[model samples]
Target chain A: MVSSFLSGLLGVWVIGVSTIDAFEFEDEVERLRYSGLIAEFRCPKCLNTNLSGSDAPVARDLRRTVYRLVDEGMTDDQVRRYLQARYGDFVLYDPPVRANTWILWFGPPFLLLAGILVLRRIGSRMTRVSLSDDERARLEVIRKQ
Target chain B: MKRAVFFAPFIGFIALVAILYAGFHLNDPSHLPSALVGQRFPGFELPELTSGKVLGHQTLLGEIRLVNVWATWCPTCLHEHTTLMDIRRATGLSIVGINYRDDGEKARRWLSLYGDPYDFTIVDANGDLGVELGVYGAPETFIVDADGIIRFRHVGDVNDGNWNREFLPILDSLTDG
Candidate 1:
């Protein structure tokens, strides 16, 4: 019984130490917001990893900045804007709709519509091709045979 | 309409080829556009690398200078150092260094080993100024005009090839204006 109690105490101490490294939030909502924000921004120093996924020094700095901003009662949009102002729109995973980025936003749908139109045209043409009377007669002869 | 539709794919193929070819000729796509261009240099009161004396953004004012971000750990900075020295020798352009996230002793040693090209190096030990300036990595050079406004930023090494082709025109234009 004494050994089990000591083991339980050791486990609790280990958990406490691990938790100390994690950011403490007043509420669960704040914690969720912090995680969401870090996952949303790309690590500037890294090739393609998000802030939460990267071990780059710059990513760590950015994560701390995000935590501080969230803790200061700034809204999610305000936090995004703060990072965007410093790092440009490159930080945001979702590129903002702008004149240059219109192609990125609208290109796929436009291509899909064009594809549908082309496919529709081909489909309609396939149906519109009537069998010639000579071909019909050949078909009738083959069926009779 | 049918004729045009028939040629649509061909036109798209040509367009795609042209775009891809142009993209191949363009600079590295990973180079992020700087947000600080056309804006005033961010204010800071960081210590000088050698002196440890606090200096502000005002020190960079009243000149067309290059603010180069470097670190002892970054190998590219070492590769770009000779070019920086050449530019300093050739044109006498003021180059200010921001020693980003580096140990002061190593930085001083590196500078002494390789001839110093900067007007005065700023020790950004904690990288607060680096964050404010939107620096993600080392060897980023910003061209700051006389009014202390950032004109252009080059993300990679500044060599003779790019120095003449990319940087000199901007410097010339800034001088003329």
Candidate 2:
């Protein structure tokens, strides 16, 4: 029974290894397009995971879609636009600077400006405080005493 | 000056908290926004489930219809079956089914057992159209207007609460128009 179980485990491992890398491309350009798209497109169902990396059903469906479109002679922009139209902007990792997402694009720069302003104000305040010569001499006298 | 600078972070924190608080109110987490809204339904040729007759965009053109993407494998579709039946009966609204990524025999059997609620069912065995529609999972429904434009999408099981809240209002307004 133990021997049979070990063989079963080995069989499962072999199948798993074979299945994950099963996708084939018709040509090099299609393969390149497929790989590039998979990295860029987000899986709608698995929010954080991209289409190529995710094993989620929706991701797999999207991958198949990308392959079909690429095979059908669609350009990279067309493929991206088609997906964006179907899945909305959420499916693209780098979403466009639209009304809804302008904050996302601008927020970091805005925060940086705010940070610089604060730092400059603090720096100025720090520079304003200096030891007078009299105070320095008094400190020297105290140290000597 | 130092105090004001220190207070800036606290003010920013409070502003963030307020924005987040407002965002929570604005967001309805249940609804997955449909990309097809305001756009015409994706054209497709599908074999009708019962008759195996080919139906395409022309079949869905005239009526304000509900296209439900469902399969036997999806548990929520089973739960939503009765609600679908009632919607058909009550409103007499045409509910078209897209049997997403499912076996034809299994889908037919499941529908017969559950009681067929759909006016017509489209067999999407390979889920080609489902991918085009960006269907994430089963039991996703779209409300298509008379002009073939997709008006709204409901992403999960259509229970009484959602029906009353979500589907009814749209139905009323569309009918009113």
By TM-score, the best candidate is: 2
Report the poorest 10 consecutive residues by lDDT, candidate 1 chain B: B7-16
| Candidate 2: segments with Cα more than 4 A from true spot | A1-26, A131-145, B17-31
* B1-177: candidate 2 lDDT, tens digit per residue: 668875785587577678768877896644456778888898999999989999998899889999999999999999999989988998888999999988899998998898998889998888788888888888899999999989888888889998899888998899999
Top model number, lDDT: 1
Task: Show the lowest summed lDDT stretch of 10 residues, model 2 chain A.
Answer: A13-22
TM-score of 2: 0.86
Q: What is the lDDT for B69 in model 2?
A: 94
Docking quality (DockQ) of candidate 2: 0.38
lDDT of 2 by residue, A1-145 (tens): 9988986786575444322535677865666667778878878887787787788777777888888888899999999999989988888889889898776687657666777888888888899988899999999999998
TM-score of 1: 0.84
Per candidate, native contacts kept equal 0.41, 0.48
User: Comparing to the true complex, what docking class would candidate 1 get?
Assistant: acceptable
Q: Give me the runs in candidate 1 sitting further than 4 Å from their true place.
A: A1-26, A130-135, A142-145, B1-25
Which digits, one per residue and each the tens of the lDDT, describe model 1 over residues B1-177? Answer: 986986675576577568768877786767988887898899999999999899999999999999999999999999999999999999999999999999999999999999999999999887778888888988899999989999999888898898999899999999998
